[model samples]
Target: MKTKLNVGCGTDIKPDYINLDVADLPGVDVAHDLTKFPWPFADNSFDTIELINVLEHLPDTIATLEELHRIARPDAKVMVRVPYWNSPDMLADPTHLRSFSERTLNFFDPAFPECKDRPYYSTARFNIMRKSCYIRFFYYLKINARFLTTPLFFLARYLGAVVWVIEFDLRAAKSDNK
Candidate 1:
């Protein structure tokens, strides 16, 4: 059985996974605010963790991601989805403390220049397996087609307010020490 953790699950509760949220909603298995440090789960506790539409609301991006790394088991899958920085979706939510671009997550990868030159920023390491962005057209039609991430579409997104949501699928790189 897959031991999955739905962090900041909010109203999207899952039956089989461990659902967690800030409020004690109907099916929320844990009601702890994610902003606090040292989550109740043990280190290396989960096989898969989902942070869909969650990271933007947190104040400390690096610290919060590091905490996720601490709990994730070796090669565990970490799914992150956040509103694209240039989109109105990011500004619409006042609770969203930060915005994210496709390059935002690369800072945590050791091989990436963002991390390689500044290793002291964090110990967290994750290999990005895949990344994609969705474009929202007139707040109604959403273009989540794979072609949106292609070079042409990707460049187009950067030139305008196209990509609304960005997602990253990561594989945690851990050692016995961490």
Candidate 2:
């Protein structure tokens, strides 16, 4: 059976997957603080993990990814969705400690130039499979057409607040157990 983890799942529960949240919400399997080190799970415990709208709330960017790495099985898929830096959601939510851009996750990819230049910065590694930025309006409209992504990204860069959410589909690239 394929084991899956829904990290920081706030009321959005999934059947058959381990639902985790900070609070004792309905259907939550693990109600633990994500900020704490050494999450309550064995190493390489999950085949897939999802952190929807959760990464930005964590304080330490590198540490959060590292913890995610620690629990992920090799080639595990991790889906992360965060508010774009230019989005009003980035500033609207006082709980959001950080925001993201198209290249924000590149630092964790060893194949990327930023990581290749200086790898000592982090121990965790992941291959970016797919990434997309969405406009706040289009996101609400649930229109995620690939053709619109590039144009939206371009517009968001030149004109601020065009994109609201940035989604990353990452595959865990782990070697040594530790």
Instruction: Give the Å error, residue 76, model 1.
Output: 0.3
lDDT of 1 by residue, 57-120 (tens): 9999999989999989999999998988877888888899998877788888876898888778
The alpha-carbon lDDT assigned to residue 47 of candidate 2 equals 89
Scored by lDDT, the top model is 2
Model 1: colliding residue pairs: none
Candidates' C-alpha lDDT: 0.85, 0.87
Q: Per-residue lDDT of 1-178 in model 2, one digit per residue for the tens?
A: 4489999999999997999899999999989999998889989999899999999999998998999999999999999989888888898999999889888889999889988987998989999998887665544665453557777887888887788888999999987565
Q: Local error of candidate 2 at 65, Å?
A: 0.4
Clashes of each: 0, 0
**lDDT, model 1, position 120:** 88
